[model samples]
Target: MKALDTWERVLLTLIALVYLAFGLGIEGFLSPYALADSTYNFSEKALIALAMALLVVAGEIDLSIAATMALCSLAMGFAMKAGASLPLMLLAALATGLLCGALNGWLVTRWKLPAIVVTIGTLSLYRGLAQVVLGDQAITGYPQTLSTWGNGSLGDLIGVPALIVPIEFAVLVVAGLAVGLLLHRTLHGRRLYAIGSNPIASRFSGIAVDRYRMGLFLFAGVMAALAAVLLTGRIGSTRPNLAMGWELDAVTIVILGGVAIEGGRGSILGTVLAAVLLGSFTFALGMLNVSGIVMSMIVGGLLIVSMVLPRWLRLLQRGARPALRTV
Candidate 1:
């Protein structure tokens, strides 16, 4: 039902068409194994997208999230080099993410700076710190278990290829469900919509607007850090370029999912479905040997279409109804 909402239906249809087109044209493209494996392509960015959705719905944005991930991964590397255990390494990344997020939140909420401006500054700052620290080097040789878990699957663990479900995909699903519920079902969620729609009115009506904004930004940072953990685990190393340029991808997926860039109109289900659509699109293109340049063009074109089509349809639907009004 969630995926069948007015706009979400369109996303589902697109996803289906992509799979059908790719499946018909590319051998083995529709195989369960292949489809399941594609989750890794977008899982990390999608995780940040989920948190970013909440922030967007609350009338804020964090362009520094990818940078946060880079910094977090670098922190994890530092911990590993210091002989931290696996859990401590994970903690290091998360704490760094939280700190970065808190800084953004503080700058925006306390100093009354615009969120976009604050995050953009931090984005450069965070990534620069990582680049400066690593300086044309990478940190590697993490504990083997981290790599195993990063690339492992439920089916792989159980030794059943037929049950193939990427552990990353499983985590994404759980997070999607959790965030969807939080955004759609709780009083706190309702307040976010209220805040985005009219922050002054919501504040006058007793909502803790700044508090929500701060929390959402913090949440965005933590999710990005979690993504960093997974990505580091997968590659078994920390590179300055890790997750570079992912913030745009995350925002693009959120917008494609039908969230209003201005705020107050979107759903987690739509964002999650959009994420799946993108993963499938990239996977399909890769299967058909589509060049990266062409694929980027196609994706950019789709982003434009997603932004315009709804407004165009709304205009068409208006149908000059003002003339039918009885004065």
Candidate 2:
């Protein structure tokens, strides 16, 4: 408990420091509206990141999430073109997501295939399906309500620009809280940790490891679909390549949040903070006119650092223990 608390504090402090630096060093980063707008940069990705964190904690990875988002967005677009109502469109997106998730889960749990390999295969398959649906074209002219949900702010009610956050961002916050509670204060969470720590032992202990993994995959799919809705609303279009490479970003956020890639250790709070940190960093770079490729490089570098730093620190601590004993 004490160690987890300490790690959380460290993450919180790092977030604060990063924000402070960007606000002071970058032009327009301190502006109230700029900060609010930046939330849009990370909100959708963070939504999927939350689910990805859970899956990682259960000792699995899903590279298909971004592709799944594209597929869901394509489904929603098709439904809208068919004159479906807003609620119907949402249902279409959610259902599409659930089905995609179920497919991944089935392949892994039922077939007993490795999760990494299964998701990698599905990643290409889903994205290819999306391309087939859209076929070198884009879908536009979505309803106004969806646009409002994606891009609108609550400033109309709050009457304060600084306090006015995007509706999508607010939704992300609420979802984060719910997931945090589920992970830290629930029996299901304990089972996930157990499964990730040792699957054979977990099964011997009567844990339904395969069932729980399937559920996690399903959850991940649903969230990815939800993110697709928000993203399509914000952009008011669906393109086959939409959200391309976002899987890497989601994984980066999870790893940077201190979630063990091997599973069985992490927190939603840390994931949330890490999302904020990465979003803010990316936004700050954009303010400086950084290119997308440069941003990708930075993200890759951060991912490497995040993975290596903890292990390096642990080694130093281990070495210091022997010196202390000799003294």
Highest lDDT scorer: 2
* Alpha carbon lDDT of each predicted model: 0.88, 0.91
lDDT tens per residue, model 2, 1-327: 234344467677777887889878987787888989999989999999999999999999999999999999999999999999999999999999999999999999999999999999999999999998779999999999899888988764466665578988998999999999898899988888888889999999999899999999999999998999999999999999999999999999999888999999988998998899899889888888999999999999989987886567566666656554563
Error of 1 at 88 (Å): 0.4
Candidate 2, 59: how far from true, in Å? 0.5
RMSDs, each prediction?
2.4, 2.5
Q: List the residue pairs that clash in candidate 2.
A: none
Runs with alpha carbons beyond 4 Å of true place in candidate 1: 1-5, 158-161, 320-327
Prediction 2 global C-alpha lDDT: 0.91
State how far residue 169 of model 2 sits from its true place (Å): 1.3
What lDDT score goes with residue 312 in model 1?
Answer: 70
TM-score of 2: 0.94
Candidates' TM-scores? 0.94, 0.94
